[model samples]
Target: MSPTNPSLSPERVRADVAELLGCDPAEIGSDDDLVDLGLDSVRMMTLVERWRAQGATTLEFPDLAERPELGHWTALLTGSAA
Candidate 1:
């Protein structure tokens, strides 16, 4: 699912990331580089699996690891990225 997919939401993405970081979703900024927040490969792979289960089957670790930004990830997962 993508573009019109209803499974992935920015809030959910933020929460997932926040959970892995052991922080509150509200503390995460959309443009913040998650890698700087300590989002290593292990957590990134976990997100890939989680988003896949949510129907973001197109999501991959490199797609996120390359940029590691919350806003960009939301776009990718929601299929709004250019």
Candidate 2:
């Protein structure tokens, strides 16, 4: 993937989130709340910035923070559910 246009797939989202959470991607269920897993604002902002830099230009902090679920994020990033 290029620096300005990332292929934000479900697996990639899971991997990125899992990497920050210190857990395996498979361990995170689609309905699981990321905040419950210790995801703070700092980490969330990190994702927003990362995804934005990777071409998620319209992604905002509240977009993810409003619903911190794997499936929700997957759809938001990739425009489809896994």
User: Could you say which candidate leads in TM-score?
Assistant: 2
Q: Model 2 reaches what TM-score against the true structure? A: 0.90
What shift in Å separates residue 69 of candidate 2 from its native position after superposition?
Answer: 0.3
How do all models score by TM-score?
0.87, 0.90
After superposing candidate 2, which stretches have Cα over 4 Å from the reference?
A: 1-6
lDDT of each: 0.81, 0.85
lDDT string, candidate 2, 1-82, tens digits: 2122347877888999999999998999999999999899999999989898778888888888999998988888887774
Model 1 C-alpha lDDT per residue in residues 1-82, reported as the tens digit of each score: 2322468777788889999999988888888999999899999999999888888776767888888998888887865532
Q: Scored by Cα lDDT, where does model 2 land?
A: 0.85
